[model samples]
Target: MMKEKGLLIVLSGPSGVGKGTVRKELFSQPDITFEYSISMTTRVPREGEVDGVDYFFKSREEFEKLIEQDRLLEYAEFVGNYYGTPVDYVRDTINDGRDVFLEIEVQGARQIRDKFPEGLFIFLAPPSLSELENRLIHRGTESSHVIANRVETAKKELEMMNLYDYVVENDQVKKASERIKAIVVAEHLRRERVEARYKKMLEVK
Candidate 1:
């Protein structure tokens, strides 16, 4: 029997929605089996960062060539630097029967959806707009103006929840992590995923 292909699990949300925090929590769990997809970037590695571990560092020309070749699943430019997921890595990992998890921005998630509609898309939403705004303010890393702009953008992103297969609310970091894990478990057990395995068994019998 052929081995089942693994899932492409995407987790995305608006800025200041604690996506990083929730992802860290989820990955810390021993039971989590998905491999994190390392993104490629055209930027200098920060101190203590390692290539192929932190990010697959690339030159602007090299990265652009990848774009031209359509080797990237999704990519975006921010502050003159390009960051993206490599299509080959994702495809190879899943084909090897190892799930690949992507933690990315809302726009990047949309891009992934376009290319991989069969992948599981989960929208990480804040409990409320006011709560989201408050979390942004508490972070104290951005200017008040920047915070306001992010809140507005988050409102627009929230509307995109309809595009996702599941919505996991960020009520608490632990709770959100638990919910996401549960979703992944359920997705693996979905009928469509298991039907082929069962059918192959019957054929062999």
Candidate 2:
């Protein structure tokens, strides 16, 4: 029998919804093999952030060139910076039969809906909007103004949650990750994902 092709998992959420935390937890699982799609950005690197690993830092001109060449899978401008997923890496990884995970914002996710409808889209949400604000405040990384802005942006992003195939509430880190893990497992067993592989095997006989 032909082996199943890897899934393209797109994870998205509001700014303070802890999607990254859950992604990190998911990666810790030994059996799940996935390659992360690193995004390219026109923003400057922060302290201790490595090039190509944390983000592919690019000049505005370089980023624009990629856009012109249609090299990006999905892209959006946030807070005056350009951010996009590189198409080549993600395509190659999935073609190689390894799952690829993309952690992106709602705008980028919306774009993906058009380009990659077959991919599994999961939305990570906070238990409540108020709780999302609290988490942002506790982080102490942004000014009150920025926090308020993020909260407002999150409220808008939450409205788009219905667009996703599944919604995982990030009330607790571990629980959320487990829910996502379950989703991945279920996706693998989906009839559509398996039907083609099995069909090919039958035809060969």
Candidate 3:
């Protein structure tokens, strides 16, 4: 049987919507096979963040050079730092028949949509704004002021959820992960992806 092309799955959502948690759980499933796309950034590495594993950190000059050379699939500036996906890495992995998952924010997801319209875009959503605020506060990683800022940003970003192909509410981590996994399975079984494979067999017959 001919192999189908790999899927490019983009996960996007507002800040503190449990996207990272969902992604973590999704990959833990034994049947799910995918590669995580490591993003390149011009920001300083946080404590304990490894160079290539956590992120591929680059200097501003190097990042700008990449932009000029069209090496990035999509890029954006946040908090005065540049973050982008390296085009070659993603392309290579997908071409090798491995699904690639990009956990990104809304703007970066939109850019990916433009570049790869056929990609599967899933939006993660909090159950409610109040719940989202509570989770952010409970984490205690940020001050109240930062939590407030994140809440506001989340509200604005949530408005764009309609743009995604699927919206999964993160009421529970495992449930959300299951829903997303189902979507991935469904996408792989799409007619367009399977039609060519069937045609090749029929031609042999």
Candidate 4:
């Protein structure tokens, strides 16, 4: 039997676009190929965050060593802290016939696209800027000033939507989730990805 080729799915969007909520629903469906990548970080563990669950929680020195050794597919410095995606885990998981999903900002997505041109890019866009701003305000979890900053950044991020391979409008939860599921299923049957596998499976020696 031919093994399934793994996919690198990149999810990128501004905050309050409902990417998290929609992705949660899709991952819960269990009808598609998706894996949450555990990112490694040098930041201190936040409240209720397990050592290896929310993040790898590595020491700054260790993270730098990995960067020096070129063991990271991508790494970034945010607010004086370091975070990165380990290359080995991604390579191994893909070789095992499973798809890997990366949840990152637009910058990270761009970097990955530059390296892996064939990777799938999906952007989750809010129904409207007003609705997205409302979500930020209604969230009520962050300070007004912080929310404003996030909204400002979100507006800037929206400009990059044209660079994505797929744009998923997250207006209605059910409809958006269905759209994402269909996108995954369709990509799985992409000629290059499935053609070789089917050929191997049908080959008679």
Error of 4 at 143 (Å): 28
Global lDDT of model 2 = 0.86
- What would the C-alpha RMSD of candidate 1 be, to one decimal place? 5.6
Q: In model 3, which runs have C-alpha deviations exceeding 4 angstroms?
A: 129-158, 201-205
Tens digit per residue, CA lDDT, model 1, 103-127: 8888789999999999999999877
lDDT of each: 0.89, 0.86, 0.87, 0.79
Give the Å shift of residue 9 in candidate 4: 1.0
Q: Which tens-of-lDDT digit does each residue in 41-105 have in candidate 3? A: 99999998889987899999999999999999999999999999999999998887889999987
User: Clashing residue pairs in candidate 2, if any?
Assistant: none
35 Cα displacement, candidate 4 (Å): 1.6
Off by over 4 Å in 4: 129-158, 172-174, 200-204
Evaluation by TM-score, superior candidate among 2 and 3? 2
List the candidates ranked by lDDT, beginning with the highest: 1, 3, 2, 4
Task: Name the weakest run of 10 consecutive residues (lDDT summed) in model 3.
Answer: 128-137
